[model samples]
Target: MQTLEKPKPKYTGKRHRLSKPELLAPAGNLEKLKFAIHYGADAVYIGGQHYGLRSNADNFSFEEMREGVEFAKKYGAKVFVATNIYAHNEDIEGIEDYLRNLEEVGISAIIVADPIIIETAKRVAPKLEVHLSTQQSTVNWQAVKFWKEEGLPRVVLGRETSLEEIAEIKKHVDIEIETFIHGAMCSSYSGRCVLSNHFTDRDSNRGGCCQSCRWKYDLFEDARPAEAWISEEEARESSVLKNFKLGVTQLPLFNEDDNAFSMSSKDLCMLESIPELIEVGIDSFKIEGRMKSIHYVATVVNVYRQAIDSYMADPENYVLKPEWIEEINKAANRPLNTGFFFNTPDHEDHIYEPEEKAVPYDFAGLVLEYDEETGTAVIQQRNYFKPGQEIEFFGPDGTFFKQTVGQIWDEDGNELDAARHPLQRIRMKVDKPVRYFDMMRKRK
Candidate 1:
């Protein structure tokens, strides 16, 4: 056997400190990656086509990853990839090469869960820094120390850890600590639910999560479920008893006043608690939504960027603006809560009824090119909008104005009553100036 000469050394620069916390955003694809960085994310985490845990996302090709990295470089930002899938025997086949490719493509780091993946990256892809995924559920300083000693640069703490515990962890270990400050929460511990695998045959840890935890279910005193409460034989027997009365009645633990029973949680929002999170010495604030829309990415990123800058610029003068809350709510989201931050979430932290999800705004269009002299702007439609409908425009700098949609024209100069077709380019008069990448939304 022959060894290559490039196997010179292992990564020694594992643990370090950044002067300021980075705003880490999720990028499901190349476009979202660009938008997140353009809107002021310090770093963006993306998933490759294979090995990453977002098989449902339009995960990047190596070319797209390279492009994203280059784009982020232009903004002095960074790009990380999520090769964080827990692997089976078959999943290990080409991982070493994949890790090598990631490093070659200039990926700043990788968020990994499986121990084997971490060790492999350290050995085969030493240039790619490894950040432990939240799936490890690192809750204490001990686990953090172990990882830091093992030469990992950072640990994304479990969502269950509160600010006090985070401060304690930071005090004990001088390692980069990342935490999820916003987005969805799992009913199970750090999203390690077996319902997806056991019920729908999709492995959540390996990227095929069904989010079964959010689905509505019927709780019956008499019904035997597939869990340990009932034996498989008895549950199977109960399942086959549809024809026979069996002298048993199924009763649900719900009422008609509500929509239904679901174990789903309210989405997390740490906008108001930014100062506390900064005080805890968190190195990164992660937002969890790789499959979300581009509008969601831009809006959330823009809001957080402004809030963080405002606070860091003047902590004494920092104020949580009401407009920031309003802008964030305009994005598509479930009810917002501070999950496990204040305390263990009670009933108030969950959305038992999906009907509680509030979507007050519809993303209407994206500004492709604005003509200043003619007072016209060309937009690619997202949702339907018609003449005389009230719409609002906003940019990454947080400028927005409400205006009634006036006369619209197609590219062929034909007057249109409505912008009905998706991605249809339409020209319209603008009372205020809008430019490239500005977005328009309609209030519901």
Candidate 2:
């Protein structure tokens, strides 16, 4: 028999981006879920305490899961529960029960990675939508078609795919492709590396990643060791390894700089390239932080919501404000890059720095009741709202109103220095009408 080669697909640019695809964001816990809804996520994805990739983050309990779903529902935002981690046989034993409960609670979707779990979801919660998690490393049209045939309602495309590749896949496939448009990027492809597991027994897939890949190391050669790794310089200079590290120890053949393939890039940031993504036909855009605080959630969500709207409104004159970028940076973030969207994957994306020191910003309160006619807002601060500092009030329609703090009054109309307790309701005057779920923040 004669062999024949498979034809390479040509880029004819037939398919284009959706006019208005869903904006999906990650919610590690109940509060962030609220933030996601408030700031303008069309849908939010959360993980139960088990069977998710982010295990160590403050994940939701079953009770919290119910509340999270309800919270998202109130604002017309969908909630997708993640059960997307790779599982062993034992992990599958009680899977049906979990699926049943999630389905019963009206979860919008159940994201899964393992084919077994997908099967389980289909069999147990046939009514529930199944989204294929990116952990599956789905890159090509064949794999995309196979999963769609297997009954996945959507697929969270791998972070490693370039914009052009994504558009190419969209042309060939009819199924929806969800992609991580912003937020963090894994140093490795689709976050399927064992560096964290190998070094610290904390598997990232299992949700216990210690992030040893982001740790500083020294290069060693037969007892001789280089003190530190310059990731930028190394990435630009070396072809053998794009990401080089300093070896913490010296051994006969253990050269951390040369031998360590564990070097992954820093996380990805693609806020500026959103228009490019929209032009590329992405069905859904995902923000990648569940471990982050509610403030982080609110800021990123608000910025993206505005950006998406701005682009949709008038892409010809669409200009992202410098303030939006600054707002994103206020959250805990690595050095930013466009990821593999524009150029090839480079080692420069890796976080060579030590731990990120966050400039403190916390969600202080939300307007529970607002009387626009009276111009008075009744808010419940999540934390103590110390008076006298200027605070930002993020309203429902993406209008950020800043007001100088004045006399804080209790329900009795008596003034106080600060709302010094969690869930403390305080009265404040607003220049304009504030709606329910509108966020008020005090940056420390």
Error of 2 at 358 (Å): 0.7
* TM-score for each of the candidates: 0.87, 0.82
Query: Of the candidates shown, which would achieve the greatest lDDT relative to the real structure?
Result: 1
Q: State the lDDT at 130 in candidate 1.
A: 97
Q: Mind giving the per-residue lDDT tens digits that candidate 2 earns over 112-139?
A: 8888988988888998899998888888
The parts of candidate 1 lying over 4 Å away from their true place are: 1-19, 220-261, 356-358
Off by over 4 Å in 2: 1-17, 222-264, 371-375
Q: Rate the local accuracy (lDDT) of all candidates.
A: 0.86, 0.77
Cα lDDT tens digits for candidate 1, 238-336: 656552235444556767676666788888999999877876779999998998888888899999999998877776677999999988888847888
Give the Å error, residue 333, model 2: 2.6
- Please state the error at residue 7 of candidate 1 in Å: 52
| Candidate 2 lDDT for residue 121 | 85
